[model samples]
Target: MDLTNFLKTGTYLKLKVGLSEENIYSCFKKKDLSKKYYYNKLDKNEGFSYFYGDGALEIMVIDSKIYSLQFDPARYPYILTLFNNIIISHKTSFELIIKYLDIADIKWSFYQRYCHSRELTIKTEENIFIGCVYDKGDYKLSKFQVFEDLYNGFF
Candidate 1:
């Protein structure tokens, strides 16, 4: 599956928003890393989902529905290509990232400012939201998210 498209459009291959947990499970193979990753003896939890391998990944679940997808580039070397010539890397600086978006004429904005890290969000042409978190120490890319719902508020 083209993950770039998924990040930009919020649709995983043929899957769409509001799909059941079972649907998500069927779409991707997942390893139960709960014990290894979370140190939880339990097998599974309704509040969490996993796609652990290669790069560290996490999913948020609400009422058995996929809420969002998150990726950690710092865990593994991964490059995400959003458009023809636009790509995101772990070491990509905030200024460089925003420059890429601006060059592509993509709409984006600073979503929030935090003590240790800050967030920037971009609404795709599909109206889906994609967010990135940058480290305060170096202002490098830390992680990014693809949301399943519309969010207009800022904090």
Candidate 2:
């Protein structure tokens, strides 16, 4: 009955650890106007950086199959917002993390000195972690991140 097992097994945009660039591109929009990507020989991977609404997606692939991805914070005027039926950027928020994670229920250790804490990492029921890091002086959230266990045997 562990929810992490079910949640961690899921994919983003139906794109899993072994999906190709063509397979991934097929599942989402093809708006090259906002599409920006590159290939890194050192990593031996291709990267695509695409905008979604005011947010963005950065996908990385090696030998043609994706192994990692990221979602930027939610934004307004949502356009090309569908990443998957389960996870999303626009729906992502600190409150959303608490609703789905409830790390506090597990007695999980986290830091939140106040409403303006600089950073926080909440371990999720999915065995993944989502965080928002802030700029120190102004305490402005500078980054939104999702950390997932990397696929084994896949670099």
Candidate 3:
């Protein structure tokens, strides 16, 4: 299929990493990832609930209902701090950021619209409509600032 058609059909799928069911199961049983987190099997009549970090986040019930549970990075303040630090430290311009995203295998498209705004159309490999970036103004900045602006507006 053509790229546009393939994207529309959601034919792309992300490959699984080395993490396995058995490994996840063991971690759950032993509470290896975080002692504060725990999981319980749902009953046949009930839907599964994947709780994370003192039950602050739930994976949400779905059709099959079998899901792995663990600590959520968002639940910890340190995670956000670390993320912000990383984003700030990455000294990459908009051009370099786009290039790096391509190298990182992220599916995205870039466009220049008008003088003040640049558009960044993005999608997941699975054709999920991730979002876009519209550079409102202040396009010229240090590499770090450019990257920060893009990432800050990515969502």
Best candidate (score: lDDT):
1
Better of 1 and 2 by lDDT: 1
Per-residue lDDT over 89-154 for candidate 3, one digit per residue giving the tens place of the 0 to 100 score:
112244644554465566754323212334343433432232223345423221110110222222
Per-residue lDDT, model 3, residue 78, is 25
Q: By TM-score, rank the candidates, best first.
A: 1, 2, 3
Candidate 2 residue 84 Cα shift, in angstroms, is: 12
lDDT-superior candidate, 1 or 3: 1
The lowest-lDDT stretch of 10 consecutive residues in candidate 2 is: 138-147
Model 2 regions lying over 4 Å from their true place? 1-9, 39-54, 79-96, 103-118, 125-127, 135-155
Deviation in angstroms for 143 in model 1?
Answer: 1.9
lDDT of each: 0.55, 0.44, 0.31
What TM value does model 3 have? Answer: 0.30
Number of the predicted model whose TM-score against the real structure is largest: 1
RMSD of 3: 12.6
Stronger candidate by TM-score (1 vs 2): 1
On the 0 to 100 scale, the lDDT of residue 97 in model 3 is 42
Separately for all candidates shown, the number of backbone clashes (residues 3 or more apart, or on different chains) is 0, 0, 0
**Residue 84 of candidate 3: its Cα lDDT?**
24
TM-score against native, each model: 0.63, 0.51, 0.30
Q: Residue 134 in candidate 2 has what lDDT?
A: 50
